[model samples]
Target: MALLEVDHLSVTYTPRDQPANRAVHDVSFHLSEGEFVGLLGESGCGKSTLGNAVLRLLSPPAHITGGRVAFDGVDLTEADDEQLRKLRWVDLSTVFQSSMNSLNPVIRVQAQFADTFAAHKVPGDVTERATELLELVALDRRVLRAYPHELSGGMKQRVALALALALRPKLVLLDEPTTGLDVVVQRGILTRLAELRRELGFAVLFISHDLGTVLEMADRVMVMYGGEIVEDRPAAEMLREPRHPYTRGLLGSYADPRLPDVRVSYIPGRPPDLSRTHAGCLFTTRCPHAEDPCRTIHPDLLPDRGGLVRCLVAQENRLPVVTLGSAEAATVLGSHFPATGSLDRPADAADAAPVLTVERVSKRYTSRRGMRTNTVEAVRDASFALRPGRVTALVGQSGSGKSTLARLVTGVERPSSGEVRFTGEGGADVRVDRLRGRALRDYRRHVQMVFQDPFSALNPTRTIAYALSRPLANFAGLRGAAARERTAQLLESVGLSPAGQFLDKLPHQLSGGQRQRVVTARALAPEPRVLIADEPISMLDVSIRAEILELLGDLVRERRLAMLYITHDLLSARLLADEVLVLNQGTLVERGATREVIGSARDDYTRLLLDSIPNPFGKAAGQQTLPST
Candidate 1:
């Protein structure tokens, strides 16, 4: 028997007045012993709901409506509250999206483990288990006594994972476990998770928005849309040839560094409505190959090749590559230059006026541990400038303080000591540090920021309408109807389709990518002169990251918005940036043109980072001794 089998599982959530909201609809899949399966979709397509349903964590107003969820032949769907409580952590464990917040802040980490053990009537040497698990996650045992605040984001996630494995359950469900972490940290955690799976011999249901990570970790993959599994296949076979038009669009939508940037496209619209009753293919509205049949008939999951597809057109028509010819690049890439969008729009010339200038800006913070205060310098005299309509990227290792620089630039925190001069504000120049109150707010209006995780950045309670309107009302003085129409325009501009549906849905209702799109729309609503995107795509999959980047790039060129692209990724910098600044240990190591920096590196630390980027093209990491500049 399979370790876990979810047959035709359906979950629904309902508000007081509205109809039942189907989060998962007739999704069926099974995992064998020690096997791995990935549930892939955009943010709102019900992957997490499926994970929650399997774990029996779906709260009031949301419940399993249909089908059987069997774990090792015991019906989990029918399992009562007490049965679920006993089964969880001991028999089936789940690492939730917000697992970092799972720990009790008042209780010590070791005590938390002790509670779990005591409840289970298992051996209570919690320290040993905690130490072993910490070692497994590459964390020091000293963290056992520390609270969650003491741990870094990556460290907290590791601790959460260790707790999930404390019982060594037969099944482990991971929901976007590596969502907000940087690439290096993400890779490390995934490797550890893979090791845990092998060591414990547990079945995995890994849910992620990033297709690349899913393809890397999963044995089999399923593409979900509007609460249904639209496609299913072996991860490799699916990546090789996805049959569903929605699946094809999803695969093509995001730019994976492993693949070349060309031949990429996006789904023209947002996902389907879960609350509205529909008798069609869930993805028909956004699908390019949708026919009359698609809108009228609901397709069933039937055998295709290696797995299954749930679209009549997909069953009949072979999937297309959805290649972008020269015209596609012209409308997008040409905006970077003068000829495509506007004639006098200006190319990235050396003579362009510099907007925001940073000269030797560095920040440091001291940690007090028993009176021995160790000063940790975050930024090391990092210097760069945003030119007319060009992108300047900050590339570095995790703690090198790309975020610190962003905070400094946006006046979130004053730098420890350094100069940041504004040169070409049409004679409206002001030092970033000295700018106070009104000046700071004015400066902020000129510069907007986009965060990594699309979901959390947005307010879950508010509709997208409210979110996109806040900036316009606060920054631009537009309110009421003015704000609403402007919100629609901003939504369309950011590529969230229809714009009508998004205005009503809450943040949790959207997918990770779409929530991010709404965030971008909010940032753009203020009509800022500078857009500071901090690791914007680090939380996204390979497929969707490029789409968001392209959106930003398009805005930069077409709207002439100066962009500060801050990230730890060298490859993304190469693709999106005109200039790149390399930071190491809170210090600026090098700055040059993107092509120049990537091609000829004079500094060892810069080269280390450039080399660190996984060569998606599969080239050997070059060995050229770089000097400490």
Candidate 2:
């Protein structure tokens, strides 16, 4: 018997003010014993809703309207509350999308495990079982005594995985388990899960927006769009010859780091609104190959070659190649997008003048725990100069002093021993630490920062207008109608058109892309000469990323602003930066023109970082493929 099966599943949400939203429309799939299946799609495509429906965890305004979910010959939809209570952890379990924050902060790791055991009524020594599970996930036993905050992000996720597998369930549902994690840590977690599945023989239903990781980890892949499954096939076959246009578009969204200088493309239009019904295909608006019938007839999943696809054009073998050409993408990126060949090397600019300069700066932190005192060097004699109309990228892994350096430059913290100096067009150089009163205020006005995680950076309760106007009122001394006029202009500059529409809306009302744009607009409100953006696009979706990068590059060139782009992804650094500075363990290891440093690196650490990026394309020669479960 199949381990899990869903036949004609459907879900809908009925909000009080708005019309009913049909999230999942007649979605159907199955997972066999010991099989690893991947569910791939973009955000708001009902991937998480389907997963939640299968687990019977959907809360109101959302509910499963119709479906038959059978697990091991038992219909879960018809199961009683008592039966569900017994079946939950014993036969089925789930690891959620944000499992890193799932643990209770007040409890120790082992105590949380004990609670799980008590609820499930599992018979065993709780402490020993916890230790064994930790070992299975490649974590040390010491983590059992620590709180959730004490553990790193990856460690917390591993703990969640261990907890889910505590009862040795027959099947596991994993939803976006590795999203937002570093590539190296993501690979490690997936590898560990694969090993455990092989040893324990449990089926898996993995849901993610990350296609590259899915291609590497899953045996079979299913593509979802507008709450419906569009294509289903073996992982290799799907990547090699994807029939559905939606599938191909997703594949093109990610750029393979192995193929340096490659241009990636994304679907342009927004997803369909679920509250309003569609007559034809849900993806027709963004489909490059969309035609006559696609506008009037809704396609159904039918056999095409060896797999099943829902596109009429695919069944007739008329779909064009989805891989976009460089010139085509460039035109789509618009003529105004900065070209690599058009700009001079930032370090060699003829009119270069230092906006901010750091000279032999170092910072150290001293911490005392119990009876031991330890001193850690965050930055070790790092020196660099920021020139106007230039972008210099500081590339490093986490804990390599990237954030520390940013704080030093932003005046959040002073260096322990060295000097940070700033010079204007004709003004004498001013030491940062010596500034006070009006001098300090003036310096802050000229220097501003755009932070990572735009969602957290903005106040959720405040309107967008309030957030943007604060800096203008405090620094530029504009208020009331004057401040409002400038706010609208700032919003327009960042590509958020019709500023009046967004001014009154709260931060939560806007999309991720729009929220980041508002954050960028807020930073630009003070007319700062220097902007420090730290991993600004890391949390955004693939399609929205290029737009934000283009916006930043345009602002830098048009305003003659000095930009410090801090990131761990070398691909992005190469795309936006003219100069690259490589840092490792608080020390500057390499610095040169962007192309030279990326193409021919002398440092082994830099090479390792470049190589660690996940290749979304097919496997390279001598690459180790994960063994199928």
Candidate 3:
């Protein structure tokens, strides 16, 4: 018998003034004991909603309209408050998308764990249990004394994971558990989770937008689209032969950085709006092979090749198997979406003068605790040059000084030693470190940064127009109608077309991808010669990532701006960067052409980062063959 069964589940979000939106429509799935099943899809595709619904975690404005969530033979939808209280942590637990949000900021880590144990009336020494749990996630027991703010992102996630497993629940639901983590840290968390599962024998319902991670970890994979389960199959089978076109498109989107050459592509167009009912196939708009009948008749999920698939073409056994990046793949998979730019090293880039130069730059921080002074080196003698029309990728692990370098370059931090120089107007070398007041303000006009989190990077109280216009007025001395016109042009340049439509919209009104574009447009408002983008697309969906990467590349080529691309994703680096700089422990470990550095990495740290990347086609996939349709 299945450990958990979700039958005809439907979740709806009904606002008082707006129409009802069915986030999860008739979704059904089953997970056996000790099995790992992954729910994969783009953002807003209802994967997270379905996961939450199964646990009865949805609150006001969102409710499970219909469906039976049967866990261990108990119908969760019918469970009373008392029953749910006992079931939640004892039989089932969840790790949310953001660990910081899930953890209480005011409470110490030890107290938090103790509260859970005491609330459940577990008979044991809470501290001992907490220590064991932390150890299980590869964390030190001393972390118990620290607050959630004191821990790193990866550590917080591990703590959350430990809390979820405290009661030895039969099933655990992980919602985008490893999202936004560095590859090395992500791999470590996943590895530790796998080991814990093996030891405790708990089932996991892993939900994520990353296709590669799901394919690499999950035993069975279910592809979700338009609030429904479009396809469900073994991970290995899905990796080799995805029956649904949407599933195939997702597979094609992933490009292994270790490869000699890769051609990554995304399905054109965005997902369907769940606010309105659809008569035809949900994915028909995005599928390249969509036919006339697909426009009117909604396809049913039918058995196909040992799994269920909702596609008319696949049901008819007419869909061809084409290797990604081949001529046939382009023809069948709709390569109409422009390429993810190119990695072609520019001939003039080598001869171009340096726009910004860092000479023996180092950053240090001193913190005193209990009359003891400790100094830590964040960046150590880093030297590099940003040339016009070229992208130099700074790749490193989380605490390896990637962001510190960005701060030093953008003049946010003063280097303890050495200096940062930028070529000013009339070939004047400006020392970024000594700039004061007006000079500093003017220097900022020539350098701008696009932060990682677009939502936080933007002011929530402000409209898109205000966000862009402020920079225009401050840096370009444009206001009124001129500022408005320039804002539209910047929006259009970032691929948010019909810029007038987005001008009045608030940051909350736009999607993740759209918000990132707005953030990019605001950065370009100053018309800077150098662009520093720190993990620009790391928070976006895979499909949207291709779009953002393409936009960044186009901007660099069209404007001939020098760019510093800081990221932990090697695959994205391979897709966008011309040159690569590997940082390990605040030290430059490797620097070379993108292809050369990734294809033939010499530094141990560089090789580790590349190896940590989730490879769906690696040995873990095993020997599998695509069945003849």
Best by lDDT: 3
Would you list the rank order by lDDT, best first? 3, 2, 1
Greater lDDT among 1 and 2 belongs to: 2
Q: Would you give me the overall lDDT of model 3?
A: 0.86
- Count clashing residue pairs per candidate: 9, 0, 0
lDDT value, residue 245 of candidate 2: 77
Best by TM-score: 3
In Å, residue 572's CA in model 2 sits off its true spot by 2.0
Per-residue alpha-carbon lDDT of model 1 for 521-561, expressed as tens digits?
88888788788998888776554565666777777888887
TM-score of 3: 0.95
- For candidate 3, give the lDDT of residue 209: 95
TM-score of 2: 0.91
Runs in model 2 deviating more than 4 A are: 258-260, 322-351, 369-371, 498-501, 618-622, 625-629
lDDT for each residue of candidate 3 in 374-480, tens digit (9 for 90 to 100): 99999999999999888899999999999999988888888999999999999999999888789988998899998899989999999999999998888889999
Cα lDDT, model 1, residue 352 = 81
- Model 3 segments beyond 4 Å from truth? 323-338, 344-347, 619-629
